[model samples]
Every structure is written in C-alpha cells, then in structure tokens.
Target: MKDFIFESTPKIVFGAGSIAYLVRELNILKKKSAFFICDPVIEKTIFFNDLSGKLKKEGFIVNIFSEIVPDPDFDSCDMARDAIVAAGSDIVIGIGGGSAMDIAKVAAITAKNRKKAKDLVKNPELCEPGMPLVLIPTTAGTGSEVTHIGIFSDNDEKLKTGIVSPYLYADVAILDPEITVSMPETVTAHSGTDAIIHALEALTSKLATPFTDLLAEEALGILYRNILPAFEDGNNIEARSNMLYGSMLAGKAFANSSVAAIHAFAYPIGAEFHIPHGLANSIMLIPVLKFNLNSDIEKYCRAARAIGVQTTGLSEAEILNRLLFKLEFLLDRLKIKRSLGYYGVTESDIPRLALSVMKVTRLLSNNPGEVLLEDAERLYREAM
Candidate 1:
C-alpha cells in the first residue's frame, strides 16, 4: 500500500436536533456578524427564518443572502460575496442544501480575500486565507458542510468548474436530521443514492487506503439500511439521522480517497442538463460501475457485499453481474429516471459532452482503470 496522509479539521455536530448548536457554535468561532446564505426555497421555509431569528437574538448581526440558485453558478457566488462584503460580515453561515453551502464557502473565501468571485473560481490559486465559516446543512448529500471542494458554473460561457482547497473547509459543520426531514421523497432518494456512489467510488479509488476504505464500507452499509426508510416515510427520524450520518462519513471517505468515474461523467450531465447533482450521479452509477468492473473485480465484490448483496459460491464475474442487477433494482425502486435524453440531451450532444468530460481529468485520473476519450463516450452513450 502507498503511504497516505489524512487530515480533517472541521468540528462536526450531528444528530436529530444539532442545529440548536448554531448560536453557541458561532460564538465559539468568534463570529460577531453572520451572513446566512441559502437558496430562495430554503430562505422562504420556516427553518431558515427561525434560525436567522435565533442568531440575531444571540447578538450576531444576521444578514440573509438568499439568492442562491441550483448547481450554483459564478453569478450566484458573485452576488453572495457582494452581499457578505457589503454587510461587513465577520462570519459566514450556510443553512440549506449542498449548492447553498458550497456557494457560501466560496463566498466567504472570496470576501475575506477581497477578490472577485470569478477570480477564485477561475484561478483557485488566488485564494487567500479566509474568515471563519459555520456550515449548517439542511440536506444529506454533497456534504459541502465538510468537503474541501466547491463546484460552480460560469453562466456566460455555460461551463462548470471546481475550486479545491483546504482553506475552504468550514470551521464547523452542523448536521441536523430534523432539518432534512422536509426533503421531498424524490430528493431523499436521489441524495441517498448519491451518498452511496460516494462510498462506492472511494472504495475503488486508485488512491484507496485502509482508513478510507473502512469509512466507506461503514457508510455504504448505513446508507443501504436506512435510505429507503427515510424516503418512504419522510418523518422517520431514525432513518433521517442514519442517512445524514452516512452521507457525512461518505463525504469524508471520498474527500480523502477521491470519487472517480461516476462523478467525472456526472459533471457534464449536470452542467449541460441542469439535473440535480445527486440525481445525475444516480443516473450514471450503474453504467460507470459496469465500466469499472474489469479494473478491480475483487473490490467490486467487496462493495457488493457491503451493500448486503451475497456473492458466496459465485465467481467474481458472476458477483459483478449480480451487483449490476442489484443496482438496477435500487434505481427502479427509487424511481430514478434512467436517460439523459429526458434532460434535453441528444445523441448529437455526445461529442460536446465527451469533450467536457475530458476537462474533469482531475477526477478521471483517479479511477482504477484508464478512461480514454472513446471509453468515456461509450459510457455516455450507454447512460443515454
């Protein structure tokens, strides 16, 4: 095994009612004034308002940056930074789904550095040490609350890009399942599957080490056991708590080991089609797994077993085939749509999508198997 270094700095508070720590945590982080960033959907919800009000009561000047949009683009980050800077905010708080939290991280970094949002997204090296941030996630997917990567789109050029830096990590990540209980069943299903993909890819990463694989295995089992219950009955606190905890574990696992093929392919689908990130991931998981089966069949078998698919008395190839069937069963049971065609993608767009995938070599390079241009194109075709 290769040598590895693992370092996670964020302080995590997770449970059914962890958001209650917001005020106390912010004070400990020395945040005198906070810019609470969120999407309009969440901003309008009672959860957001209640949190905002409570923060104000705690003597923090609370400014709401509620203009965040889906798959948050450069423009949204720019708007958020402007709001934070104008408010003279001393701290950043993210209180919604992944997009909102991701954007909030970038916004805090940009505001502290006094640089344009475009500069940070376009030139990640320009990042200066940032102000403190507290991430209170209202969703279970993405784990932007803890991860060091932020994805955004450039609307003018219609391209998706990423900014990766340890400096962007939140000082604290608050995961409260009560906040996630309101997620629609479809959102629950998609995000839950996305978390599963995170663990699966981490387990098979070329850089995988004992520590990350162990985390991924535990997370995969937790997700498999609880995701469906959370989806079918939105108010299942136990299921919600498990899914939330599972996603955090998967985030940490993948953050260290890296997610490979599925994410590399899913980025284009999300950038071009505007599909939600988790749903895009769900649509691509099985096809990417099939592509990856030949690279590490034993590892695949282990992953299959982690999700409770028995492969005893079966050959490696047989286990893989059974794993794909099991994945299909999960997708069908969750009612995830299977085709990019439904998202305005056509066969003619395959060439463009293929080219876009080439840009995500950062992720593609980490897969156990080589992903040639032709190989990526075939995966996209199969997914379609």
Candidate 2:
C-alpha cells in the first residue's frame, strides 16, 4: 500500500427521523437565517413544507431557491447563488439529490466570497472559504453530502466536469433514511446502482489505499445485498437505512481513491443525451470491467466474493463470468436499460464520445488499466 491521506466531512448525523438535527446544527453554527437550495420537485414535498414551516416557527427565517435543474449545471448554481445573496442567508442548506446538494455547494461559496459561479466553475482554485454549509440527502445516491467534488453539466460543450476542493466539504451532513422512503422506484434503482458503482470503481482505482479498500468492500456488500429489497418496496426502512449508509461509505471511498474508467465513460453520455448519471454508469459498467479484467485478476475475484458470488471451485475467468452475470441479473431485476442505443446514441457518436472521455485525465489516471483511443472506441461500441 502506498502512503495515503484520507479526509471526510467534519460532522455526520445519520438515522431514522434525524432531519430534526438541522436545528441543532444551525444552533451550533449560531445561524438564524437559512437559505435552501433544491429542485422544484423536492420543494413541493410535504416533508419540505413541514420542515421549512417548523423552522420558521422556531424563529429562523427560511428562504428557498427551488430553481435547481437536473444534471446540476453552472446555470443552476449561478441562479441559486443569486438567490442566496438576495436573501442574505447566514447559512446555506441543500435538500434533495445530487443536483440540489451540488448547486448549494457552489451557491454557498459564491455567496460568501462574492464571486460569480461561472468564474469559479472555470477556475475552482479561485474558490475560497464559504459560509457554514449543511447538506441533507433525501435520496440514497450521489453521496454529495460527504464529498468535496461537485459535478456540472456543460450544455454548450456537451460534456461533464467537476470542481474539486476541500473548501466544498459540508460543515455538517444529516442523513435520515425516513426522508428517502418517498423515492420513486426508478430513482431508487438508479441511485442505489450508482452507489454500487462508486464502491467497485473505488476498489479498483490505482489510488486505493488500505483505508479506502476497507470502506469500499463494506459498502459494496451492503449496497449489493439491500438494493433489490429497497427497490421492490420503498417503505422498507431497514433496506433504506443500509442503502443510505452504504452510499455514504462508497462516497467516502471514492472521494479519496477516485473512480476510474467506468465513471469516465459515464460522463459524456450523461452530459450529451441528458441521461441520468446512474443509468449511464449502469450501461457502461460491464464493458469497462471487461476492459480492465487483466489489470489485476485477484482483486476482481476478491471483489466478487465480497458481493456474495459463489467462487468456490471456480477458475478466475469463471468467477469473473459469474460476477458479470450477477450484475446483469441486478440490472435486469432493477429494469435499468443496458443498451446505449436505447438513449438514441448512434454509431456516428462513438468517436466524439471516446474523444471526450480521453480528456478526463483526472479519472483515467486512476483506472486500473490503460485506455487508449482505440480501447475507448471499442468500449463505447460494446456498450452501444
């Protein structure tokens, strides 16, 4: 193992009905006025109404920026930043999935440092200390609450990029599984699968340390076991709890080790076709795994065993085959689309997509195997 550094969110409060911890966190930060960033869909939820109302009753001024758009773009962050500044909020709170949390992170810092979101989007090094920010995840995926990385979709370039800085870490993260019980079946499937990918990619990353491997192993086991149950019945509290915990663990793992070619393949399709992040990851996973089979045979075998694959009396290749079949089974049972053609991606698009992927050197450098232009085109073709 190489010498490594592991960093995570400063504070985490997790459990059933733990959303109430928000007030306590605000008290600790000595903040009374709060600004919320979320999608319009989440703003209309009864849960949000109740929480915001209750906070207002507690004498905390609660303002909302509910204009967040999907795939979390620079425009969304800039809009939310303007809202935060107009409200003059003492604290910024993000409530929703990855989109809302990511937008809130950008809004918080931009409001504090009095910088435009576009400027920081181009140059994340310009990011300075922001006001106290709190993240509350209403879904089981993304794990944006614990991570300092925030992704954004560039509509013009039709590419996905991220801002990485420790200053983006939340001061507090509140994870209450009760809030996640309302996820639609599709959201549950997509988000949970994204968590599994996070773990697997982190496990195979060249940057993986003993610390990250421990987290990724535990996260994969829990996520793989509980995802189906949670998908079948959203009200399953135990399953929901496990998925949420597993997602956060995966987030922590990937945050330190970084994800590899799987995520590198996910970005272009997601940015161009407007496909959901998790679903794009879902289709490309098997192809990239096949591409990386020779990188380290034993590690892949260990990962299979961690996910309860029956590897006894099986050769390495056979164990790998079983692992692929298991993932296919999960994707089938979850009703996730496996073909890129399903998203309207054509043969003509493969070259550009492969080119875009090669530009993501930050993630490619962490891949278990080298991905040349020909290899990327082959993987994209396979996925298509």
Best by lDDT: 2
Error of 1 at 40 (Å): 1.3
Model 2 Cα lDDT, one tens digit per residue, 320-378: 88888888899999999889999999999999999999988989999999999999999
Residue by residue across 244-341, what tens digits does model 1's lDDT show? 99999998998889998899888888887898888889888887888889999888898889888887798888888888987898889899998988
lDDT values, one for every candidate: 0.85, 0.91
TM per candidate comes to: 0.96, 0.98
Q: Give model 1's TM-score versus the native structure.
A: 0.96
**Highest-scoring model, TM-score:** 2
Residue 257 lDDT in candidate 1 = 90
True lDDT of residue 106, candidate 1: 86
TM-score: model 2 vs. ground truth: 0.98
The list of candidate 2 runs beyond 4 A from truth reads none
